[model samples]
Target: MDTIPAILRAAAERYGDQPAYVEGARAVSFAELHDQVRELARRYVGHGLAAGEPVVVWGPNSIEWVIAALATTYAGGTLVPANSRYTGHEVADLVDRTGATVVMVADGFLGRSQVQELRAASDLPSVRAMGELSRLSLDHRGEERHVREVTIDEVEARADAVSPDDVADILFTSGTTGRPKGAMSAHRQSIGVARAWAELGGVSADDRYLVVNPFFHSFGYKIGILVGLLTGATLYPVATFDVDQTMQLIESERITLLPGAPTIYQSLLTAPGRAERDLSSLRLAVTGAAVVPVVLIERMRDELAIDHVVTAFGMTEAVVVTMCRDGDSAETVATTCGRAIPGMETRIDAPAGEAGELLVRGDYVMLGYLDDPAATAEAIDADGWLHTGDVGVLDDEGNLRITDRLKDMYISGGFNVYPAEVEQALMRMDGIQDVAVVGVPDERMGEVGKAYVVGTASADEVIAFARQRLANFKVPRLVETVEALPRNLSGKVLKNELRK
Candidate 1:
């Protein structure tokens, strides 16, 4: 099987001068990108990073980010991207789990530096700063090896030695059971995701890709970086998701593809000069992490003039189970998250209703969560059916519809209440823009619902509005109105933070 770097070699041979990645004022051609990966991989090998070992890639999206990722694959090392938002302790835990011998990071991001904080991890392999990495040379292998450069032959020959089943990345995902688990993705399967995305979307070398999702995320790291590489599509890296900045870049660059969450889109819509901006170059858009309401789809198609909107579903495991297929009706694209991708088995279990734990069985499933065998056993069964803790169902045509998340369900006065239901109910109310419902501890009922709302309505007004429709028990006892609720990089509600 062709390794990840081999895809670049193909692009280099076929479309050498074609621009492969673009960031700010720079654009890297396919041939140039490949050479950079080759040199960087050689540098990695020269530094003594072996095939069986791993390297921690921590930083936001940038041209260097993709270079480091591909370089790791070429050098035959597992790529473990530490969460950019991770605390020093959290990063330390990931480093320990991956057993990375080298950590590659970008320069001072957001003025709050990381190189120093990450170096403090006693368990760290070696800290390699971005500023130092730019100066990496392979000639001297051992002259202060915390971050040295290695050669093309050394990396490519090892790349030739690497196989499909080799662990490519250890992506840590927050599990429903409290602690996070590291999901191992293999080389071939990583390519499978890339291939599935390209085939589904018909992405080609002509496309200019804008990656707004965090580089650490599987959706962005694997599908965006790896898949974009496979297709020879030029990558436009966004370090942050500022609305005005994103809009300006889109209009200026004419970015052909955008892979981001709904919140990012929402933010961009609200940006000043947004309606006047010329975004005709954006041919395709992909959004996930949360359900995309029909209204959002209408807005994108009507307002943004995007031709196709792909709603994808999957975590680190299962790669991506289902997506709204090309030419699907707007309703399906907006509501149902389409059928299973090739080589993946998606089922609704006993009865396909409005909601259930979405079950999947596939080779793409993670080898197991890093050092969490008990949790691994609970998530992925012996027969290899990954029991996704998310609550969803298969619609009439078998399209997967995610209504609520299993763990996010709260018990209110002995009645189990899924927050999505309450949130959906709240979303229907006039002047109620966004809603996040979480269970607050209550002595009498064990737990009562509390809503953290964003937008116009005040606490009393929103509660009174809810009381008109919902039963007394279902109404939120304590409504805390806020400008915005905390969310993960993927735009997933940080329920844990709300609980805290």
Candidate 2:
């Protein structure tokens, strides 16, 4: 499909009665999805929201969140999804940055009212809770045509007014170093990546997708929701990724497809009474963000009975650059993020066999950072390559091994040390459940690796374990065991936080 609105229309016509999304006790069919989106779009129009305006959809996983997203697009507005886990200050920053005209937030999530939080943080207009909107929609029910007089043809016409090049979304990047910049993507680019990802994963109508990724992430909103629509797979949105609840959902829902970060599958593998649950229906799986243990991949297949376990690499600016294919070996799946998606091209800026910055250019590349011309120019050069601030190497077979973030690499004893490489080595260490390595200040070697692990291990023991497999320069000087590592909504460890 060309646009999200187009996908809605197409799915409504093709899979009219098939279930589209299921959240808790609520389930919506493809036809109902379209009707709800259309009705909501009319309400948005009735409220005087114009085309190309920005609307903030701030909430966790729910059918209403999905409807707000699609309705925003159908109303010819750009959807700016806010991370529900954000504090008031963070949410205020996004609302101010995006200049969102309307805020549709979940009421009292985590015992805090999102609308109250937004109001407390900033002076925003048209803030309405989801329950308020539901009541309003109910009050305006038979008067849908009379209130706005917007017919289905008129809604379609409004959706048709949105061009392929129009900015459909402004996804804020995880602000690890500085403030998060809004990465703007046109309808075509946003839809293109999801379509490619679905094809890469072999998503089919028969599949049932369990989306544990938060709705604010590109992985969840685009790949999870959009791919489900594209492939006609039933979507089950998990508001939280609790191991017990997630396993129960897979068993109860007969989930067939699940894709999340490495931590997700790792937790599922180690969950108590995991084998007692019936996860045999799981067929396709994808994980990334951290190094995937080879044994973990093997166990997922053998123990969980999952058929295809794929690994992929991408970012907010560009989605799905590389992905492991269906029949790739376990080592291949664990070690390398397989070749680029169909039409995307990736090249390392440094010498061959050496890790360097990875650059990508394709239809999937974003339009640019919203309202920041200088930053946009710095990110995407005149040659059209989007300079991904990541260090990686491409093997002869075209598979990509991401060493670390370019900013995460440090020079030690005149040699570069990538934390991801060191972290990968530490992941194989016995008694270590998860690991994050960061370069820390050192008096002699200029810099040294400091590892934060999620298991019981003494610093000396962990250093010895690393010394066995990694070079002297790569071995972590200090290993701190913690209950858990700090991570963002997408399951990426916050190394900056760790450095603190």
Candidate 3:
């Protein structure tokens, strides 16, 4: 059961009547989920979706999103997820690059029509069909007017045709140095990584997972959705992270497994009326994405009463590289992302305890970047190790501690913010001569972007200009004007000086 569909089938046989997914008023058992996914896969095949084709799913975290994404793979099509916060212009670039034939959007999310936004952004000549994700009902008996009708046998045939080595997803991750590149992962790699994470966390069928991370990310998709499929754990998806709502869900759902960025725990620790909330049900807590203070990890165990609090480090290319164990000390969990999981190897380029570029090679590393051979070659060397642009060191105990980043990228509320991308977007504004963006410390969001501009445009005007072009998280939160940006002999902006 190396493939997702195979794992799903196994889950159905093992956990049949158990609740697999619970959304608001709807709940689907493992057996029912399998049937629904197959039915939707039939719809995809009926619409002439060829094997190995790409389908883009642009929506928030929901049962419909889960079904649609799995159905794409079940129909032998590649799943390309679009960030819900991405503007239409951004999504259009991805759809065009992937040559996606179909796009399913969550229209009217956050008060914007996703379909209309993509339409206005580009004609999307490669896209042959577009469907609203909200209309995709899991009920097999309900009417679905979007896709063509096909037989269950046809869907089963398509699923059988899909091999474990075939491409399952092409997740687009922004490069700190350049444009976003689609990291391709096969079915085996995706399922393998999820299985590793589930095993490390000791995830079980009875554990209720509260997923606050967006489904588009590997954290929520591979670890959140696929982990449930492999372990039979029931998943409760949270589209947005409202502290009050999340606390309420934890108590009401009796969630046992909760994994998210450090900010989520910070919010919960300081959230209003938190003492009254019964959070004793929480057992396993995994957090990462930004620096985790030792105090935060200690507080989570003390105040929240969670038994296991661990941390992990991962990227788009390799989903689960290193993770802390169940009984790891609070200081160890806070300072280091634990040893590499089984079937993976890690090494620092410098001497033993010294910080250097961290390199990883494993069974779960991405095959390569989609249609970008040059970039792919540069990333993964001939030796087969992927050069992760992060600076870290390995302690004597084999724990990997990330000290610095080679790339000027930061995490804001668990979202990767590449400074180069923000700088490029800021340059588009008129009267802007030069700009340098740096990640500044923020208590709420792990880090926020602050732009240093050497231009005539006012800070307010520059920020306003970026708001329309980039996503809210990508936009710079603060702006400062300088006479000129400091540059080195090689003409690279000295971001360190700007940070000072």
Best by TM-score: 3
TM-score of 1: 0.79
For model 1, state the Cα shift of residue 211 in Å: 0.8
**Alpha-carbon RMSD to native, per candidate:** 10.4, 10.7, 2.8
Local distance difference test values of all predictions, in order = 0.75, 0.81, 0.90
What value of lDDT does candidate 2 attain over all alpha carbons?
0.81
Candidate 2 Cα errors over 4 Å, as ranges: 125-152, 175-177, 409-500
> What's the TM for model 2?
0.80
lDDT of 2 at 46: 68
Q: Pick out the ten consecutive residues of candidate 3 with the lowest summed lDDT.
A: 137-146
- Identify the superior model by TM-score, candidate 1 or candidate 3: 3
Across 1-500, the per-residue lDDT of candidate 3 in tens digits comes to: 68778888899999999999998888999999899889878777766678999989998999989989999998899999999998898899999999988788899999988878898999897776677788873222124434567889888888888899999999999896648899999999999999999998999998999999899999999999999999999999888889999988899989999999999999999988999999999999999998899999999999999999999999999999999998889999999999999989999999877999999999999999999999999999999999999999999888999999998999998999998988888888997999999999999998999999988999899989988778889989999998999999999999999888
Across 1-500, the per-residue lDDT of candidate 2 in tens digits comes to: 58889988898898999999988887899999999899888877766567988888777887888988899999899999877666565677777887776667676776766666666777754332122333324222222333345667777889988888889999986423335688999998888999999998889889999988878888899998889778899999887668999999999999999888766777788899997999999999998766667998999999989999999988888967899999999999999999999868999999989999999988888888888898889899999999988889999999999887756766554344667767766777778899888888774455678899898777888999776555466678887889999999999998889888
What TM-score, over all chains together, does every model reach?
A: 0.79, 0.80, 0.97
